[model samples]
Target: MSSPFIVVPTYHELENLPRFTEQLWTALPQARLLLVDDASGDGTPDWVKSHLLYQKQLFLLERAGKQGLGSAYVAGFSWVTAHLPTMEPCTAVVQMDADLSHNPDAIKDLLGALDAGADLVLATRYRGGVRVTNWPLRRLLLSLGAAQYVKLITGMPFSDPTGGFKAFRPEKLGELDLEQIHSDGYAFQIEVTHMAWRLGWNISEVPITFEDRAAGVSKMSTRIVREAVWRVPWMALHRRRLKPRTESAFAQKRSSS
Candidate 1:
């Protein structure tokens, strides 16, 4: 039977994939995991292929090159919608990193929030006094500062607007023009949330203890930071001009709730 789908974007995450997937299944046994690999030259795709033989719910989408995180997730989302099509009881689509930074156990809290009427759930690190571990103070400050900048420019009140750990009800997410999301970095996370906000989706946050990656280098770079710095203000300015589909009345739901 089809179930809530998870889209995990990966690049050279071979060290964490096996452990993450195992814990993910234990956390949500009914969920299907869609691993989107951007040509991780580290044998990640091969390992996934072998595991698929036994783990029927585990699927892989191998890309030709190392695309950005945004593109990989967009591909995974499109794949899930096209192939799995969110049947009967399964309504949510989860997106997280392949590295163990995003705790697999927190999947329950996110899914639980969705079950309790949240149209979208953000697994936030700043909800309860900066729940991040192993990150230097400088890096933590940058993240916190960026979130504030996002709030000021785009008016998104999410504590972790740039966080990669999030879930959305498939029907709510389908309202977005997914193909038009071209941001190829951390900005992609913000753009998706902004789109959902513009359409008035009821977004909620669940505090999660985000940890440093157990293995693999982080994808963060100057380009990603630069994109977010400029794109946020640009999005806020052109949001109405884009002329998205009719919005749901839940637009103010996040703030009110």
Candidate 2:
């Protein structure tokens, strides 16, 4: 019985993978996990195979060289869709950080929001007085500022539009014009939401506390941020000129109740 897939992209996260795998199953015991690791030279694939907890539940795809986060996710997404073509009760696809910044427990809330009818559920860090640990004030400001800029330029409703943790109903996402996603950096999140918005699908957010990675270096680079900032506005101005494979209507749910 194939179930929903949670696509996690990894670089040299061998040390973090085992913990993440354990946390994932605890929160989503039934969901399949697709971990796509770029050639991390850290023996990530081998490490995965050695983990007993994974058994038949975890799957890994290794690429020859380092690829951007966007490419890793795209590959993982394709693999899940192909392998679980007839997954009986239907499936949802999730993209999230492997660094533990996006808590695994929060996945339940995101899924709950989707079950309540959101086409896409973003695990937002800005909602309520949600806590984020170990982040310097400077980093927090820049991240929030970036999200605000994306929202103003793209007209997306969610405050955490730049957040990496999100889920999409597979059928709705499969029907998406996947090729329309051009930016493969931090903007990847924005591009997808923009696509969903253009398709007129229901999108909403759930609050999640984000923590800094307990180990390993952050992949966030200035270049990636610059790429996102430039690309988001450009797409906004040209959105009408582009055509997409049609699917759902972009409407918000009337009430949370």
Candidate 3:
């Protein structure tokens, strides 16, 4: 089986990149790492370019400016799909944060789920119980509340619907209409998973330990929160008429309960 392609959206994440890259490679040496940088003024692109000179599996996609998170992933995914034949073939596409909030060690479990026949595997923090570190109570509560709100609005049964750490089958990810994805921030996370869920993909969740970024500032803002608040309901209203290809274990469990 081919290795996975890891897409990480970065904005001024220089401090965390080295550690993240090292750990990720250590855990999955054969995987390719793509850093979609939004013109980070912190020499992020420069570092990537220098590494690219020697690191065969390391690739960089430098954007003109700070595009939203959703667009960054779209660009990364599109790049992977467009260049699949030329580069090392990959079986999966993984998306995660650059700020170390998404642990690299847990990547194996996410990919393992895909290897076990899951179409999409979410690295969830709320599967059995909350598993977050260094987060304030207010932020923690907001995240928990957001998960509940997304479930209520979209009827998606996955815990931690807004989590960014996820893996997708390369073909299944390419099937998504990338141009149609407009939501960003928390809404973006929900939108992608909802699309997969609607298509009846075998989505599964792997419990993970999430830690707040030890370096750099978070991009969270009032605008991101507001976008999620309104965009979620709009997504439900505009959802496609497609049904799942197969009922996921989570959905089946939820139904039985």
The candidate scoring highest on lDDT is 3
Better of 2 and 3 by TM-score: 3
What are the Cα lDDT values of the candidates?
0.83, 0.78, 0.87
Best-fitting candidate, scored by TM-score: 3
Rank by lDDT, descending? Answer: 3, 1, 2
In model 3, how large is the Cα lDDT of residue 135?
Answer: 99
> Between candidates 1 and 3, which one is better according to TM-score?
3
TM-score of each model, in listed order: 0.90, 0.89, 0.92
Local lDDT at 192 for model 1? 90
Q: What is the per-residue lDDT of model 2 for residues 1-257, given as tens digits with 9 covering 90 to 100?
A: 54567899999998888788789888878877778989888888888878664546777888888878887877887676666543444457888989898888888787788889998888888977646789989888887888889878877777887789998886676556666565676788888888778778899988888999998988878888889878988878877444545542221111221
Lowest lDDT 10-residue stretch of candidate 3: 244-253
RMSD in Å for all candidates: 5.3, 5.3, 6.8
lDDT of 2: 0.78
Model 1 over residues 152-178: C-alpha lDDT tens digits?
A: 998888999989999888656656787
* Cα lDDT tens digits for candidate 3, 190-209: 99998888878899999999
Better of 2 and 3 by lDDT: 3
